[model samples]
Target: MASYKRHLNKDYTVMPNHHLRNKDLSLKAKGLLSMMLGLPDDWDYSINGLVAISREGRTAVENALKELREAGYVVIRKLYPNQTDSGIIEYEYNIYEFPQDEKVACQDIVYQEAHNQGTCFQTIENHQQLNTYKSNTYNKRNIKEIQFDLTGKEETDKCPDKSTPEIELEIDIYTYNVQIHDEFEELWKLYPNKKGKTNAFKSYERECKKKKNPAKFEEVKKGLIAYCEYIKATNTEIRFVKNGSTWFNQRCWEDDYTIQNGKNNQTNKKAQPEYELL
Candidate 1:
């Protein structure tokens, strides 16, 4: 709601290889974006300040600012007047916010999809006590009376003439507030050619193969499912039984949720290319 500024610290410096991790921008561009996000709506921060926050040196920060300006995420409105120096040029940036319409539309779809798949309830601060009671009730009794009735007209077709079974899974998920495990990233470094490796969740399979540890793969998958549950709700409880050997992936909401069985290689010959490009 309020504008904020990036702290001037070395930890925030943008690195070259990180650009590959977040395609569509060079390290400098990414640094500028981070700087803008760190600012509040009311404050007009100087270019020097932004550079200090995002880059290790002045030149790197300046270069990143130029790239961000070209990308249209930032604009140089006018020169900031430095009363003491007449020849000095200081550019004041007008940062842009993400398009609200697109973000709202995406969030709407996510909210609806989560509801249709399982149960998603919005949190009400005032009704926290009541909601916790209901959640506990729902968790303890498998009571059919108030359980979500997922039996409205099931959508058999997603696209024109493409019919797939209406799918549902009873899954208990927990999300963690930690960064993705470094082992997952290491797995990608090992099998850079694996399709869908760009997806953080799908990388688990390749990791298991590289380590030759099937048990570790299962552990990671379960941990991922728990992490997902954790992100969806606070003090969340997801209760579901996996009847057989099943796998849950650790993906962001946008990633597809398909399971690979008894396979260690990319199955889809024409799957999207692996790895993100900057």
Candidate 2:
């Protein structure tokens, strides 16, 4: 008996430096060409398959392939089988082959053969056909153009006939929403207790709804400032303060807060002298 060992050779594809450095070709075209070269010689040449494998948009892949074909970096050949006894012709597509040099030598031969046989080569014609098919199938509409007056006059004065009820309504809504958020932000900043900001905002919104008046926000603002002062004068620790949401919910601003001296242990009110009844 004889022992046999199988040996495997590493397979790789080579790309010319000129093709990689070609300034005439787009970046997408160069990338696609390099990827095509790396594929096996017998790999499938379907455009849809290439698009899926490359993870690129179909239109982008198609355009890149067109660019490569136009640059003479790739050559496509069409094959036709011999007519059967029934006089029917069968057409087969051939995969494109990448050129080995900057000056592609095989293009003329392929073009001449295809022209003689009255067969089509995958090139600009295919791209045009694909675009035509898409346009017809989707029936996309052209973008409408807006004509503007070149004069320096304001738009309102120029186009007085164009009523803008819908536009005005949209603007009003946007302005109102912005004003509400601005007011809330001012209140949040003035609050002494910073925790539970999201909940605090929700509580503020709820208060706004209950009051149904924009002026209420101003009142809340004043209360926040007073509360911050009270916290400082009393020497209250931040941890001991109520969360913003709880303070807002309880309407703490209405409650009267007196400043007391913690260091001297003195009450906010002045102490009266203790005198015997005279």
Candidate 3:
């Protein structure tokens, strides 16, 4: 286990309003936008480089980039370097940049309609018309059927009493389980090798019980994020990555992994041994 020091950057990228307003953009495109925005200012914006950083397949990255470009959120240009003396011509990689004033007016129009309707806008083009009609019908029906209940006691009797300690304890346990489930989901997304997720979550719960304190879970989460980046920078194949349950059980977050300039130099370490859970 190694001590991980996180480098904090004071700078932040500003997301354009159009990106959020545009409901037509796919989830993958939205994710890709956020990921790209987090990159260093001087990052090389090649498609292959983006694929490596995002851990998304090349085709997915390409399609997302194309979507962003068409949506006016990004601008990509092909560059050609100088010809070599040996009469060899090489094509430079495509450069990606954000357009400052590239606002998607369609998104604004959709947002205005949503605002007027007093509801969130639907992304589907055909469904929007159906939703508007349904909303209007719902409003009219509610206005026509406004009924008043004079017997307040009936309402009180139907509701359960305030939660006792036992009930509160049960609720707390349920909430804790939900939180653990959500945290595990986030960790699983960062893990390159998605194997034995069910087993991994079970192991995570056991580990959480052993630790007792929920705050300690942050250490594992931070370590997993750092490890993900380290493995990606090192160009480690998905096959070489350990299963989530195995990694969690072994507490690999403590292992020292080094990442530098989107490259890692810690391949000399021995392979992680496979662990069979009882």
Q: TM per model? A: 0.23, 0.33, 0.37
TM-score of 1: 0.23
Query: Mind giving the per-residue lDDT tens digits that candidate 3 earns over 1-68?
Result: 88889676867665555555568888898888776656654454444466677677655676776677
Best by lDDT: 3
Per-residue error for 90 in candidate 1, Å, reads 9.2
Q: Model 2 — which ten-residue stretch has the worst lDDT?
A: 130-139
Model 3's alpha-carbon lDDT is 0.51
Per-residue CA lDDT of candidate 1, range 1-278, in tens?
A: 89999677654533234334556677667655655554444342443344456535544555565555455544432222242122212222334433123322222222122111112122222211111100111122231321232222332221123111111111121111012345555434432133343444434433432323332634554544543444343332333221111221322222332434632221232334333422
lDDT of 2: 0.50
Alpha carbon deviation, residue 162, candidate 2 (Å): 4.5
Q: After superposition, how far is residue 82 of candidate 2 from its true place, in Å?
A: 93
lDDT of each: 0.34, 0.50, 0.51
**RMSD (Cα, Å) of candidate 2?**
26.2
Please give, for residues 7-108, the per-residue lDDT of candidate 2 as tens digits.
Answer: 757775655666678899899988887776676544544454566797786556766765676676654443333432212121222223433333332433
RMSD of 3: 25.5
For model 3, where is the 10-residue window of minimal lDDT? Answer: 127-136
